[model samples]
Target: MNEDRLQFWSLYATRFAEGFGFITLVTLLPSYINTLDPTGTTILGMTISAGLIVGFYTSGFTLAQTVAIVPLAWAGDRFDKRTVLLAVLAIGIGVYALFPLVDSSASLIAVRALQGVAVTGAGLMTLSLVGEIAAGSTRANHIGKANAASYAASIIGSISAGSLFELFGFGPIFAVIVCLMFVAWLGVFRYLKPDETRIHGFPFSDLALNRRLLTLSSFRFQYAFSVTLVRTWIPIFAGVAAAEGGLAYGGLAVALTVVAEKFTNMCCQPFTGRLSDSYGRAMFVFAGGAAYGFVALLVPFAPTIGAALALPTEIVLVVPSALAGIVLPAWIPLEVIPTQVSMFGEVSPAFLPLVALSGLLGIADSFREPASMALFADEGTDDGGVASSFGIRELVWRPGSVIAPLLGGWLMYEVSMASVFYVGGLFALTGVGTFLVILVWSHGRRALVEW
Candidate 1:
């Protein structure tokens, strides 16, 4: 490969590894909850609830990412991004290998926090490098491709983690993840060129005050809550038991729910990026966010839709019986029901509609992500702190991401599982509304199309 192609692909590999490792952990969370703490445990002599355990465990990852964003982004800009990225990959190898050794919830959270740092460092550096290398005209297209690689890895990771965990337990799955990270580390060390671009002093002070970034942050801050809640809970809702307001589907079925959004997002990003490049980016961002909220509202109603639509209750297959040419064996239903049915063998009416809604979520995000990313890249390049620009973006997202899971967990445990999606959808709608108001007030309504 040529220098540019090699650079992009190497960065892509880093992005892929980051997504793969992260999603694998997310996919196995329910299993961890079941195995590690079926009921809640006490921490520091205070009784912690099951809901709180889930919240802390999930947020631990985000919290570490939140804390690491500034330092990692600064390093990427001030030093060599390639070197920083390699260091993160090395951290990732150690973190994933530690998963099998997690004996308690506290230990798991500690390890997940380390995993968070690795993910954030790798993500910030790779995105910075990709944005710097690509031309302004096609920046979104390149970013879209990078994001597509992440989403593709998400789909693969979610499915494979669930399958491997079900078959061989967490040890083999994490061992495989460790191998993937090691391979990514080797690829970066061998192929990615040293990044000579450097910025002295703190770049965030200047970039954080930029008008464009402020406007984008207005949307991103709220949008983070929406995406975090919706994306994280979809798998939780599918995998957990019915008494806990979940579908209680098998690992594979739960993975499919997670895959639905990612698969569509992966497929649609490149095209959407090119479109955003040609047309106005802000429009796509607003439209996508609004569409996502609307879809999220519908997610809670999936079971109702399935039941109302009267989809198949039990799938039947024909076999050649000894006495007949073709016969349906009673035993066939027994085999299919356990793996396919939800909630004590009454075929889950919600599966198809939930998957469909998840797919819609993906389609909605596809419209927003690339356009939003390109806008950041544009301001970053113009301001001469591309890494810091992306850093601020990640920084802005941290609050919402860190808090949303805690809120979602509380809502799931206290109210209902469906309440999480309701609040998530509301956040998206409100975010889009706020963004539009800010855009028109500051830039005029014409800015919607012209921006």
Candidate 2:
């Protein structure tokens, strides 16, 4: 392979590893909650509720990500991006290796925070490098392909993590992740060249003031809350106990729900990105965000939809005779690994509907993501601060991503599970409204098409 192809693929491999680790945690989160059973804790003379502790599970990660962005982004721009990418990948290996040692909610939170830093740094560097290397005309197309690689990892990681966690618990799962991280690190070391681009001073200072970027941030800032809450909660909703306002499905079932979105997004992104390149990006952003909100609002109605459609409550899968022994030890009675496995523990009318909704969420985000990313790449490339631009993008998302989990947890425990989706959906709808108004007011009505 030529240098360019090798470099791109290496970067994509890094993205894959990052996504794999992130999604593994997400898919296994409900299991962690069940195992750890977080309760109220007294810290500094103040009592924190279990709900808040649950919120901290995710928020801790995003909080670290938020803190890491500025320094990482600046490092990528001011120094060698390839070095930055490699450093993070190394950190990732250690982070995944630590997961098997987590014995309490506090340990999980601390480990997740470290994971946040690694993931954020890897993401900023890879994206910034991709945007810098690709041609302006095909920037979104390339970015789409890169994101598709991540989503593809998410699909595999979620399914494998869920299945392995069910069969063998957490040890094998992190082992796989650590190995993947090592492979990605090797790919980068062997094939990817050092980044030569360097920009002096803070590009964020300039990009922050850019009119077009500000307009895009108007939408992204709010959309962050919507995506973060809905995406994180989909698996949580499927796997948590029914008493927790969930469907109480088994591991494989939960994986399927998470996979649905990743699969659809992976399939659609390249095509949607190409289309966004031809059609106006702004239009795609607006339409996609609106559609996502609409789908999110329907998540709470999954059970009703499934009941009305007369969907099957449980799906029974018969293990093939050849694989039965391999799947589980032969000495362990057939009762445990019975010929037929119940995918859903009990009657779960909401399973299919939730999966379908998650898929729709993927399709909607496919359009919005590539278009939004391409816009940021455009401004960053034009201004010679691609890394910082993406950094700003992350920073804009930080507030919502950091806080939405806490809100979702509170709603799940206090108000209702449905309330999380309601609030998340409203944020998207209102976000688009603000984005459109800003787009038209700042750039004029014709700018949406022309830009």
Candidate 3:
């Protein structure tokens, strides 16, 4: 195979391994916590608290994604992506190894914050490398494949996580992930050779999350915000639909949603990724945004579960993949800007989305993600509060999302499946507006910055 082809596989392997952090939880986390904490225990509440606290803690993780990306990408640009990436894998594996062994809520939260930091490699370095190594023509297709690997990982992660939980317990489940991270690190180190590149210094200092990255990073927050909001309701919506439709899938709606999206995102992202490379990043961003808008419309109006699964195809494929694939490929190049100095590095890693969804994630970490991201934003970044600001928003979603489960199991559970679809669509539509405003406001400055 050609060098590019070889690197593609290497990138895929690393990404596939990295995906375990989030996807496995789709099927494993809730019950896993229940196992450790049991019912009505503080430990279980800690998981919810962890989700909430992690929103804040996740900001720390964003440092790994951006602050590190700035310096590392600079290295790759100046020297070799191989060395930079290998170092990342080592640090990542070491950090991820700590994830499974935490014995208390505080420890687990610390580990999760650390895991959030470690999770940055696949997203920041590996994905950015695809753009660096591939000719522009083929970059998006490669990204799509990367997304596919993630989807595949999500599907497999869920399956494996659930089985590991059943067979071995959380400790072993974490061990499996640790082993996967090790193997992934080794794959990149041994087989993935980086062809030498000669660029001027990746300008670690220049890429500082200064005005430019910060300003543009502000724009990026819109997409993240919208995504967090709409996604928060997905699990609730899906479960409600399953129950209302009288499908056996009711209980596992989140898992099934995760499986569906993982597969579809894997299948479709490459095409979209490629399209963004050729047509311009805005094309895909707007297209995805439009599709998101369309999908939002579907949740509100979907007549049947099958119809919900069909065209305008956003949620039909949205599962656990990259926060609803809300990404507008044009913006991803920011991953390379010296994360610490660049706006993307300094401000964006966690706060970009957290500012929007910290609360949303805390709440939706249970069911949705996009809804969490979309909760709030001002013309500037700090203008908004975490999802906690929209404290009552859950009250709106609870009726359809949280309550339906309680009620469905209790009285008047027989509500139409379409109602959940409609409710989710409303949250999604709110996201659509957030996306459009961001798209319109940040019109000129879509160019990529290098560290």
Q: Pick the candidate with the highest lDDT.
A: 2
Between prediction 2 and prediction 3, which has the larger TM-score?
2
* RMSD of each predicted structure: 4.2, 3.2, 16.8
- Per-residue lDDT for 156-239 in model 1, tens only? 999999888887988898888888889889988988889998899898999988987898899999999999999989988988
Model 1: how far residue 278 lies from native, Å: 1.2
Best candidate, TM-score-wise? 2
Model 2 lDDT per residue over 289-401, tens place: 99999999999999999899998887888887668767777687755666778865665778888988999999999999989999999999999889999999999999999
List the candidate 3 regions with Cα displacement exceeding 4 Å. 32-79, 195-219, 229-253, 293-451
Worst 10 residues of 3 by lDDT: 371-380
Q: Give the TM-scores of the predictions, in the order they appear.
A: 0.93, 0.95, 0.58
Better of 1 and 3 by TM-score: 1
lDDT of 3 by residue, 330-370 (tens): 55654443322221111112122212222222222211222
Task: Count clashing residue pairs per candidate.
Answer: 0, 0, 46
